[model samples]
Target: MHRNHELYEYLMKNSWQMTEDWYKQVDDPDPNSLYSTTDEHIINTLKEQNQDYFKRLHKIFIEQEEVFLKEFEEWTIELAKDQKHLDTAVHYVVREFNKTQEVYISYLQKFYKENQDKVKLEQFFLWLEIVRKTFQLSIYIYMEEAQKNTSKQIAAQKEMINELSSPVIMLQNNVGLLPLIGDIDTARAKLILENTLTQCASLDVQYLCIDLSGVAIIDTMVAHEIFQLINALKLLGITSTLSGIRPEIAQTAIQLGLDFNSVRTTASLANSLAAFNQ
Candidate 1:
């Protein structure tokens, strides 16, 4: 009976000590009902009961460690299947996980420096996996947000192109000011021609100015089109003046052998307007 009491006391003391150690290691005391807490408590109790019991507990712990390590190795292999040529978010997650493993290894080295206990290493390895999984989840969230932002920007650009391609502003009768915005693609050119021709016909403006100040570049096709439009306006008995041709464009025009015969060119809209008024 005395032996039984002594064994009970020793078991309780050892269980309490194990709990304290676990708390110190994790720094957070889980509810005693938690699986981890319950497992540790049971193991501690069994180990303190008899010498054979302690040996059995150690063997069980080793088995559990082996299973966990196998799982961990498989998880790591799956995560790093295609890290090198990773183009998508999944690949990016793999790469980040691989990077996190390096950090995890460093942490393990730091913690196991003095103790060199296999049990401690196993525990820490499990903890490291928990951290890695959490980090991977966070990276997935970040990638989702990045993809959303990219999609939004693409949608906005499409809307902007639609607005620019389809005429957003109506020309007032007798108003000759045409402010061009953005790159002058073929669609934009057609829109400009339609608007300008309509305005000229309806407004009966004697002097028409084609402003090119906002134009970034004038390729051969653009120059040829402009020349054709100018000749057509002349046939309609209207004088067309080209304004705001940059020196670079002038050079390109000369190089491309584009002739602007009898089509008046000016440095600015102000100069063109002054010439028209004269």
Candidate 2:
């Protein structure tokens, strides 16, 4: 209806005022939340962001639904990736979003009340539905983007942990020590193989001693990967020494018919070090 444009203009004028009112009414108790931030700069940024959201929301009255939603999604993604928002609890963010939607609905109700006779009841209901639907869509988009950002951060952390866990400690000239611990899954074994080869080359190490005293268990696939690493090291012209081959692991190697003739074997890490010094 023609009144749609009138309502849009009305909301547009009150955009910054709405932000101020909503912020004043915000009652966040959690100190960890973005809403609870006391920094003047952060508060100003939050207000600006809220005003920006209102600007985008009001555009629905004039813009095509598809176009509006696309721009809304862009705004959602930017807010979702914001470090401050990311640091805040997701539930708190959603709570604030719902609160903001309530504020918008109240404003719409006020506008409808002011022109109760001119705007039909059905038109008022339609406008309310649009506001609610748009807010719901924004929330859905925000959650998805936040989840994706979290996944990427976790993957990066895992990579750092993997690199740290599989360190190739340089012992002396052209020699390094790799002490593996805990269970060796196929995935970790593969990481070790790749990481070790790269480190050996970078450090210009001609010899590597791999100690397995801390390793409690390894599956068949992991054992195969370890052997594959040794073979890889051979191709790189690096000699490899295996130490602390637990009886269980030794049995697995024998059962698998693994050929250990190509690499040096030692009873313990100390023995390997002694051999290296000889």
Candidate 3:
């Protein structure tokens, strides 16, 4: 009975609960204790009395094992996923460190005694230093990569803002320069107009120059936008000059019949600046 109590306590600590029959099975009569039944007979009676409890305990044990196995499998999968990048970094570090270790070992073997004890401590210290240095180097490489990625992202964001803002590049005090680059869609054209107008008002410039050397061709929508820009600039009391008229663009503008009669035109940026100076 005492042994049964201890076992029950141990089982409860390990998250195993028993049925009511458990107590009845361990408290039966025994002939060995100067009673009517024999000890074996008492034990057999207990087993018979608690058959259902034993069966339930067996089922619980099986379920607990299954639960532990499932959790272990899940943990393994998560660890595998998390370690992929770390594993690559470790591989790189190990490969580079091994090469350094080989060179150092070769150099040491030539000067040191050949016995294991003679160089074991020195080799251990050397390997420890190599590991420390390798860890530092790996950290440095990771930091460098992170910095480069951050720089690229910042640069991209700035460029996007500049593009959306349609920043006007002022060339000289007299010349209000707007160097058109890349494809100029209708939205971009509107941005260009707004930026130009803001710059013209702030600078109080008399001549506004539009350089189209970077532009490939003129479409109808872009041509109309250009015409609108000319009108908007005229209302702001600033004269707008067009430059870098590629022959293909000029031909396209003519085919589209984009009305540019009110705006002055030039062949090159240099020519426009020259005309402004005069």
lDDT of 1 by residue, 216-244 (tens): 78877777667777777788787778889
Question: Over 4 Å off in model 1, which ranges?
Answer: 1-175
Compute each candidate's TM-score over C-alphas. 0.39, 0.90, 0.42
Cα error, candidate 2, residue 181 (Å): 3.1
Question: Which ranges in model 2 have alpha carbons more than 4 Å from their true place?
Answer: 246-263
Clashes (candidate 2): 0
lDDT for each residue of candidate 2 in 73-173, tens digit (9 for 90 to 100) = 89999999998998888888888889899889889999999999888999999988888888898899889999999889889988898888999999886
How far is 89's C-alpha from truth in model 3 (Å)? 19
Segments in model 3 whose C-alpha atoms lie over 4 Å from true places:
1-165, 171-173
Using TM-score as the measure, what is the rank order of every candidate, best first? 2, 3, 1
Q: What C-alpha lDDT values do all the predictions have?
A: 0.53, 0.88, 0.56
Instruction: List, in order, the clash count of every candidate structure.
Output: 0, 0, 1
Judging by TM-score, tell me the better candidate of 1 and 2: 2
Better of 1 and 3 by TM-score: 3
Model 3 alpha-carbon miss at residue 78, Å: 23
Residue-wise C-alpha lDDT for candidate 3, range 10-107, written one tens digit per residue: 33443222333233233324323311234576445434423332333223223454563455344323322332223333334234334433433333
Superior candidate under TM-score, 2 versus 3: 2
lDDT top scorer: 2
Model 3, position 146: C-alpha lDDT score:
42
